[model samples]
Target: MKINTYIDHTILKATATVDDIKQLCKEAKEHHFYAVCVNGYYVALAESELMQTDIKIAAVVGFPLGATSSYIKVEEAKHCIDQGAHEIDMVLNVGLLKSGGYQKIIEEDIRAVKKAIGNNVLKVIFENCYLTTEEKKIACKLSLNAGADFIKTSTGFGTGGATLEDVQLMINEVHGSVKIKASGGIRDLNTAKQYIDLGVSRIGTSSGIQIVNPT
Candidate 1:
């Protein structure tokens, strides 16, 4: 399989600078990645740098922590789209999910954000590291019910990254309704391919180059 098409080249570190984003876009252009995932503040910069390319710009909302109010996440999603973000990877409100409030709140929050962005792709990050098997299933169900385009495995800033078990569980739960994005600890070609084999439609990693060229 062509690995480039499955990758979402990512750079979400707080220390990332303009030069870093520039280099990111350059690498993404060279590798022909499916998209370049970045912070909201850099959406415009990344868009400008990738204007001539077919690469899509993905902006993060609620980021590593999903505790922000739903209204704030909606605003963040809207602003990112305004800045030319073609897709959004948004963090789910972990607290709400864990508090037993998920059933009522989770799907609505995702639907609201998806509606705000119009036709832009929406990938909901479950931050699976903190969830139990049952909780993960619940989150995936909520995401699908909310009409999210993809259900992501992790935020990468969480206590842990994506695992085979998590990916399997998510895929099994979501069935074939929504696509899956495996993020977090996908650092090399083997790991990347493993996720692909498990049926992940997208791989989110800062190690895109290493995975693409493991020499």
Candidate 2:
């Protein structure tokens, strides 16, 4: 399979500069990646750079930590979409999920964001490192129920990144209703390929260039 099509070529570092985002957009266009995932602040810049191309712009909300209020995340999603973001990869409220408020709080949060974005794609980040197997399953079910387009594994700024087991578990739990995105710590070709082999529909990482053209 063509690996480039599965990548959400990403650069979400706090230190990322305007030049960095420009370069990222350039690289994504040249490589024909599925999308260029960037911080919400750079959505406009990335959009300006990627205009006229088929490449998509994906903005992050709630980021590495899902501790922000749901209201804030929804606002961020709206602003990014207005700035031309085609997709949103939002972090789920891990605290709410672990506090036994999974259905009431977390699910509602995701649903609100989905409604705000309307027809745009929404990928809910679970930050899987913080959950147990059962919690992961519950989160997957909640994401699908909440109308998420994709159930993402990590934010890449978490304690750990994606794992094969988490990818498989998420895929099995969603049962094809929602897509799976494997992100974080995927630095090489073999690791990325393994996740794809397990049926992951998208791969999120800053190492997209390396994964596509490993030396």
Q: List the residue pairs that clash in candidate 1.
A: none
The residue-by-residue lDDT of candidate 2 on 1-215, one tens digit each, is 99999999999998999999999999999899999999999999999999999999999999878889889999999999999999999999988888885577888999999999999999999989999998999999889999999999999887999999999899889889999999999989999999999999999989989999999
Task: List the candidates' TM-scores in order.
Answer: 0.98, 0.98
- Report how far residue 88 has shifted in candidate 2, in Å: 0.5
- List the lowest-lDDT window of 10 residues for candidate 2: 95-104
Candidate 1, residue 143: how far the Cα is off, in Å: 0.4
